[model samples]
Target: MKHRRSIELQPPAGYAIETERQALATLPQWFVMHARCRACRHQTPIERRDVIRRCGDTLSLATLARRLTCRGCGNRSGNLLLLEKLPRD
Candidate 1:
C-alpha cells in the first residue's frame, strides 16, 4: 500500500517542528517550497515534478538548484520555497 501525507504551507511561520529539526544548520524546511523570481521579484510555487537546475558558472557553484523559469518571461530562475519529497517510481 502507498502512504499519503499532507503538508501545510504558510509563509513567514510555515515550517513545523519536526521538519525544522530535519533541516541542516539553520535553514528552514520551507525553503524548498517557495521560489521567487529575481526579474519580477515574484514568488513561484515548487512542485514535486520540477527538476533541479544547475548554474552555468561552475567555479562559483554553491549548492544544488531546484528553481524553474518564469512563465512571464524566458528566464529560468526561482528561490524554491516549499517542497515535499514524493514517492519514487
Candidate 2:
C-alpha cells in the first residue's frame, strides 16, 4: 500500500503544543512517531494507539521526550520523526 503525508498536521518545533487532552490534535490516529534517542542511539517507532492510551492527548512531544528513557541504555531525550501517511490502495 502507498501513503500520502498530511504535513499540515505537524506541530511547530520550539513551541509547546497546547491542548487539553488531545496531544498532536492535528494528526490522525495512523500517525506514528519514529523516535531516536541521541543519548543511547536507540530508536523506535511509537504507535498512536499506545501514545493516546498513555498520554491521552494531554502531553506534548517535549514532555514526552523528557519522560521517555532509552530502552537500550536508559538515556533520556531523542529526536522524533513523524511518518507520512500511506495512501489507500
Candidate 3:
C-alpha cells in the first residue's frame, strides 16, 4: 500500500488574515477593538470611532498596533491589537 501525502490549500488571491492589511473602516460595527500591551499584558477596549478620527479610516490594524503605547507599563514595543465579536440581537 502507498502512503498518501497531505495537500495544503491556499486561500484565494486578495485574501488576508484578520488584523493584517485590515483597515479601521472595514471593521464591522459589532466588533470591538482592544489594545494589549506585550510587556505588562494589560488590555483595554478602544473606541472605533475615536481611532478612525485620529488615525484615519485607511490606516491598517498592523500599523495601529505599532503606534500603540501601553498605559500600564508605558511600553512602546510589541503592542497588539485584538478584536472581539459581539452577539447580534
Candidate with the greatest TM-score versus the true structure:
3
lDDT digits (tens) for residues 1-89 of candidate 1: 22355443443244343432332334433334545566776766544223223233221111323335566555675433444443334
Least well predicted 10-residue stretch by lDDT in candidate 3: 1-10
- Candidate 1: deviation at residue 30, Å? 6.9
Query: How much is 28 displaced in model 2, in angstroms?
Result: 3.2
Top model by lDDT, which number? 3
User: How do the residues 1-89 of candidate 3 rate in per-residue lDDT, one tens digit apiece?
Assistant: 22356443543355334676678888767778899999999999998889888879999888898899999989999898887767667
Task: Decide which is better by lDDT, 1 or 2.
Answer: 2
Note the Cα lDDT for every prediction shown. 0.41, 0.58, 0.81
TM-score of each: 0.32, 0.55, 0.76
Model 1 gets an lDDT of 0.41
Off by over 4 Å in 1: 1-32, 49-67, 77-89
The candidates, ranked best first by TM-score, are 3, 2, 1
lDDT of 2 by residue, 9-41 (tens): 554463333323335555554445666777666
Angstrom error of the Cα, residue 3, model 2: value is 21
Q: Could you tell me the lDDT of residue 4 within candidate 3? A: 56
